[model samples]
Target: MQPGLKLSQKVFFLVAVPLTVQLTFVAMLGHLLDQAEKEREREGRARQIIHHVNQIHRIIIGYIAGVAGEGLIGGGSKLEQSYSLRAGFDRELPPLQALLADNPKEFAHLLRLQKKAEASAEKLKQVKRMFKHGGDLALAGELPTMKLILRDLISELEAILSEERLIERTSPKIQATQRQRVRELLLTGVILNIIISIVLVFYFNKSFTNRLAIMMDNSIRLGLGQRLNPPLSGNDELSHLDSRFRDMTGALDAAARKERAVVENAADVIFSLDDSANFTKVSPAALKMWGYDPAFLVGKHCLAIVPKVDAKKTMEALNKVKSDDANNTFESRVVRKHGEIIDIVWSVHWSEPDNLFFCVAHDITERKIAEQVIKEAEARVRQILESLPIGLMMVTLDGKIVLANKTFEEVFGFNLADIEGETIDSILVDNRS
Candidate 1:
C-alpha cells in the first residue's frame, strides 16, 4: 500500500517483464535470421563446389572420348590437340585433393573416380606410343582392342560423376529444414511479446487509473457533506486522500452548526437554492439585501425571487452550468419578498450524482460597473491595432512568421492565409536551402 510498493509493482510488471520478454524474443529472432543466412550461403557454396567438380569431370571424359574416337575413325589429330587433356587433369587434381581433405569420408570415392580416368590416360598413352614407334598399319590392327578399353573406362567415370550430382541435389531439402526452424523460432518470439504486453497494460491500469478513481469517488462524497469509510485498497496517496476526506467531513459539521446559530440570531435573511432553482435553506443575510424573511423564502422556487424579465435567462444559465465541466457566475435582477428589484452575482455548483445542486448570491452592482469600464478599454485597443499603417508581423523563435498584417501581403506577394502553415524554405525556388 506504500507509494514505493505501488511503483515497484508497476516497474516489475510493466517494465521488467516486458523488457525480459522483448530481449529473449529479439535474441531468438536474430539467431533464426543468422541461421537462415548461413544455410543460404552454405547451399550456394555447395552448388559451386559441385559445379567445379562436374566441369573437371566433363573435360576429363571429353578428352579421353576424343582420343578414343579419333583412333577409331581417323588419325591422332584430336588426341594431339588435347595436350589440354593432361593440363585439365593436373589443374583439377589439387582442388579435388582439397575437397577430399575437407571431407575425408568422401576421399575413397573421389580417389576411385580419379583412378578410373588415370587408367584410361595410361591406355591412351600406350596407343599413342604404338602409333609413334610401330608402323601405322600395325597400330591400326591394335586400335580395335584399345578403343574398347577406352569406351569402358569412360563409362566408369560417368557413373562417379552421376553420384556427385545426386549429392548436390540434397542441398535444397537441407535449406528447407533450416527455414522451417527459423519460422518456428519467430512465431515463439511473437507469442511471448503479446503475453508480456497484456500483463503490462493490466499492471499499469491497476497501479494508476483504478486507484485514482477510488480516491476521486471518496473526495466527491466528502464534498457533499457525507460520511465516507476508509479505502479498501492500498494505503498509498489515494488512501491518504481518503483519510483527509474524513477529516473534512468532521470540519463541515462543526462549521454548519456555527453558521446556523448565527443565522437564527440575525435580523437579516440568507438563502441557498437547489439546481431546479428552488430554496434548500436561507440565512439571515437575505433580509439585509432583499427585505426577505427566512420563513417567506423556505420551500420557494428561486425564479420567484428573480424579476420576470430576467427569470428565463437565469434559468437558462443554470441549466448550462449543469451540463458543462466549468462553473458558471452571472448577475441577474432579483425580486424581493415584496417585489422590489435588486442585482446580484450568483455562484452555482452542480452535482449529477446527488440529482440537485446549490446556488448562492451576493449584491454585485459595483463589480458590474467596473467590468463594463474594462470592456470599453479592450475595444479601444482592438481599434488602434486595426488602424496601424505599418505591416505587423509576429514570428516564432525558429524564424517562421505566424501572423502578418495587410501591408505584408503587398511586399511578399502572398496572403497570410496562403502561407500561414508553410515553412520558410518552401517558398524558395531552389528548395535545397
Candidate 2:
C-alpha cells in the first residue's frame, strides 16, 4: 500500500526464503550423514566377521596337525585334543551367525557357511565320543571323517571372507558419490531461490513502491491547497487517485467559501460550546443582539449568559443532549450586555468528534410576549367555565370529556391535569366496576 512498507515486505521475503532453503538443506544433509554412518557400521561388522572366520580356520588346521603329531609321539591325551577343538568352535559360530542375520545380501551366504561349520563340529563331537570310548575300533571309525569335513569348512570360510573384503572396498566410494549428488541438488535449489528473489525485488521496487510514493506526494500537495500536477498518461489506479484528490480539493474550497458567508451575515447567533459548557465561538449577530462585542462573549461559560432564574433549566437541557437523545432545543431567557433580560430560542446538539455542543439561537422576545397573552386568555376561559350555572362539559366527537370545569372535577374526583389529555376508558365514569 505504501512505498516504504512495500520495501520492508520485499526484504522480509528475501530473508525468509533463503532461511527456509538452508533449513531444508540441513535436514537433507543430516539424513545423508545418517545413511553414511549406517553403511560404515555394516562394513565394520563385515571386517570383524572375516577376521573371526580366519582365526577359526587357523585353529582347525592347528587341531588337525596336533592330532596327527601327538599320535606319532605316543604321549598326548585324547581328552585334551578333543576339548581344544570343541571350545574354539563354540566361541565363534553362534554369535557371528546372529549378527549376520541383519544383512540380507550376505545372510544367505553366511547361513550356508554356518551350516557347513556346524556339520564339521558335529563330526568332531562324534570323534571325541569315540576317543572317550578308549579303543582302536572307536578311533578308526571317526577321525578320518572329521578331517575331511574340517577341510570343507575351511574352504567355505575362505569364500565368505573374500566376499566381505569386496563389500568393505566398495562401500566408502558409494557413500561419497551419494553425498555429492545431494550437494548438487541443494545447490540447484539455492540458485533458483536467488533468481526468484531478484525478480521479486525488481517488482517490489518498480510496481508497488514507486506507484505508492507518487500517490502520497499528490495527496500531500492537495492537503496544502496546491494544484495536483500528476503525470497522468495511463489508465492506472494512481491516475484515478490523482483525479479523485483534485475533485475533493475543489469541493473543500467551495464549502469553505459558503461557511465564511454564513458566519459573516447570518441573523442567528450560531456558536459552539466545549464539553465543559464553555463557548468557543459566537456569530456576529450575538454582538448586535446583546450589545456586547462577540470577542467579550467568546471563551465564557454558556450558563453565565442565562438569567439566574433559568440557569437550572438550561443546565437540564444541556444534560439531556449528553444522554444520547436526538437534537435538543429549549427556549431560555438571558440577561443582555445592556442589563435587560431577553428571550432567545435555543437549540443544541452534541458532536462526538469535536467533543462539543453545537448550538444556534435567535431572539424571540416578541413571540414569547404573544404566547403569554394567549395563555392569559385561555385561563380566563377556564375561569368562566368553572363559574357556569349548569353542568356544561365539552367532549370530542368520541364520547370522551376533553375539558371539564370545577363541577366536573368534583364529580369525578380527578383534576383536569390528571385526565385532561387521557382517553375516556382510563378515567372511571363513577369509580365503579
Candidate 3:
C-alpha cells in the first residue's frame, strides 16, 4: 500500500479513517437522542393513564361518602353530583380508549374497570329514580347494592393504577440500560479509531523516514564523488525524484569522462596549478612536450621547469591572468628532465572553482629557430646590397618599395623608411623612350 500510494493519497486516507469513525459515532448519538425522545413520550402517556385512574378512584370514593363538588357526592345542588360524576367519566373515557387502541393487551384491565364504573353510575341513577317515584324507603333499600357495586369499581380502578405504577417504575431502568449500551458503543468506536490512527501513523512515518534516509545517503555519496547504487523501487514521487537524481549524476559522470578523454589525448601539455602556483594536474602530453613523466611533475611548482631567466616573466603573467580573470599567452624557455632547454608558448587561465590555474603549453622551439634563421638572412642581404657600387632597392609585386639600401637612399634623397611603403612606379627612374 505504501509503495502504490502517493503521499497526498495516503494522508487523505489517514485523515478520512478517523473522520469516518467519528461520523459513525455521531450517527449513533443521533439515534440515542431519538430513543430518549421516544422514552419521554411513553413516560408522558403512562403518567396520563395513572392520573385518569386516580381521578376515577376519587370520584368513586366521594360518591360512596355522599359528598359533592368536584369528585364529591352530595356537596353540589341536587342533580349536580350525578351530572358532575357522569361528566368526569365522560371526559376520562376517551383517553382510556386511546390508550386501549395503542396497546389493547396492556390496557385490557382498564376495559373491565370502565365497565364497573358504568354499572355503578347506572345503579346510582336507578336509586334516584326510585326516590322520585317510590319514596325514601325505596331509596334506602337500593343503597346497600349501590355500595357493593361502588366497592368493586374502586377495586378495578386501583388495579389499573397499580399496573401503571409498575410500568412507570421499570421504564427508567430500561432507558438506563439503553443509554449504557450506547455509551459503550461510543467508547469502543473511539478506542478503535485511536488504535487505527496510531498504527497508520507509525507505519507511514517508518516507511517515509527509511526511504528519505536512503535518498539522503545517495546525495552524500554524490557530493563526495563516489559511485552510487540504483535507487529503491516505487511508483511514488520520491521514487521519481530519485530516478531524476540518478540520471543527472550519470550525465555528470559521462561529461567528466569525456573531458578527461579530451585532456589526455590533447597534443599540447595541458596542466593545472594550485593557487600557490604548484602543479596539481598534468596531462599525458607533458611527456612529449617537456620530456618529463606527468607523474614526476605533480605537486611541483610551475617555476620548477622554467629557466631562471624566464621565471620572473612567467610569474608576472600568471598574476595578470588571475587578477584580470582572462586568458594569457606567453613564450618561455623551460629546462627539460635531461637539462635540454625548449621554448614553448603557453596559454593559461585562472579557474576560480578549483582555485587553480589551467595551462596549455605548446612546444615552439623549431618555429623559433626558423624565425631566427630568416632574421639572419635578411640582415646579410641588407649588408650585401648596401656595399655594392650600384644602388639597389627591393619592391613587392604590388609596386610597393618594401626595402631600399643606404646607397639607394642617398641616390634618391630618401631613406628606406621614407620610401618603404611608396609605390615602385613612384620611385623608379623613367627610362622609357
Candidate 4:
C-alpha cells in the first residue's frame, strides 16, 4: 500500500502475507489435532481401566459364591480355586494401576481398591486354613463372614468403575468441543484468506489498472498530435515510463512545429509526392515559385503544373529516384498561373518507408539568362580577336595552346583544330634531337 513500491514488491506483499497466514493456520490446526489425539488416548485408557475393574469384581463374586455353595453341600472349600482366583487378582491389579496412573483421582480410587483386595486375600487364606480341618459345619459358619468381606472388596471396585465410567461419558463432550473448534478454525482461516486476496486484488486494480489505461490513452493522443495527460505520480517504473513518454511527446511536438515553420516560410518550394507522382504536400513557397496556392495544387498530379515540354523529363527523374532509391537533381520547367513558363531546378529524394518523393524546387530562371549572356559575350570577343589578328596565338601558362588566330594558323601551316589543346612542343620539334 505504500507509495513508490515497485511491482515486484507489491507482488511479494500479496504472495508472502497470505503464505504467512496460511502457515499460521496450519500450525493452529496441528495443535488442535494434537489436543484431540491426547483426549482420545485418555478416553481409551479410561475404558480399559473400567473393564479391568469390572472383571475383578466378577472374579471375587464367583469365588465367594462357589465357597458358600460347596459348604452347603457338605464339601470343604477348594484351596486350589481360592489360590488361583487370588493369583488372578494379583495379575489384574498392576494393569489397572498402570491404566489409571495418568489420572490422579482415578488412581487414588485404584489404590483403595488395591488395599481392599489385599484384605480380602488375607481373609481367604484364614478360611482356607479352617477348610484344611475338613469340618463342613465349620465351613458353613465362616461362609457368611467371608461373603461380607468379599462384598466390601466388590464395593471398592464398583467405586473405581463408576469413576472410569464418568470419564468415558465426558469423552463425547470433549469431542464435540474439538469438532466445534475445528469448524471455527477452518472457517476463520478460509475467511481470512479470502479477505486478504480480495483486498490485495482490489488495491492493485485500483492503483494500476487506471494508470495503465491512462497510459494507453496517452499513446493514442500522442499519435494524434494532441496534448498528453499530466505526468504520473510516484517514482515507480510505470510512472518513470510515463514521464519518459511525456518527454518524448514534447520533443516530437517541437520537431513538428519547426518543420511546419520552415515549410511555411521557405523561399524554395518544398513538397512531397506519393508513389503515383500526385502532390501529397506542397509548401507555401509554391505561390512564390509557380503562382499557385499550395492547397489548390495538393492532391493533384504534379504533371498538371509541369510544362508539357518538361513532363517527360520530370517523370524520368521520378522514375530514376524510385528505382535507385537515391536522390536526383534535374532542371525542369513548370507553367505558372499567368501563362509564364519558369525554369526550376528540382532536388528530389525518395523515402522508401513512406513510398513518397520529397522534393525541393528552386527557381533557376535568372541563372539560365546569365549563362546565355556570358555565351554571347564570348562570341563577340572571338570575332574581334579574329579581325585584328597579326598571326597571334594564345597559350595557357602551362604552355598548352588555348587559341590561335586564323592568320596565325595559315602561316604556321597548321590547323587550329589539330593544334588546339596540344602543347606547343609538338609543333616545335627540334631536328638536332
Best by TM-score: 4
Per-residue lDDT for 283-345 in model 3, tens only? Answer: 999888788899999999989999999999999989999999999898888898889999999
Clashing residue pairs in all predictions, respectively, total 10, 0, 7, 0
Predicted candidate 2 versus true structure: per-residue lDDT over 311-349, tens digit per residue: 999988988997864588889988888789999988888
- lDDT tens readout by residue for model 1, 88-160: 7687767766655655445555676578667767877777666556566646676685667655655644554
Worst 10 residues of 3 by lDDT: 67-76
* Stretches > 4 Å off in candidate 2: 1-23, 71-83, 104-114, 122-148, 182-193, 220-433
Model 1 residue 13 CA deviation in Å:
3.2
* Alpha carbon lDDT of each predicted model: 0.68, 0.74, 0.79, 0.84
Colliding pairs, model 2: none
- Model 1, residue pairs in steric clash: 268-284, 269-284, 269-285, 269-286, 269-287, 270-282, 270-283, 270-284, 270-286, 271-282
In candidate 3 the C-alpha lDDT for residue 107 amounts to 68
Report RMSD (Å) for each prediction in the order shown: 28.1, 14.4, 4.7, 3.6
lDDT of 1 at 163: 52
Question: Candidate 4 — what's its lDDT?
Answer: 0.84
Location of the lowest summed lDDT over 10 successive residues in candidate 4: 71-80
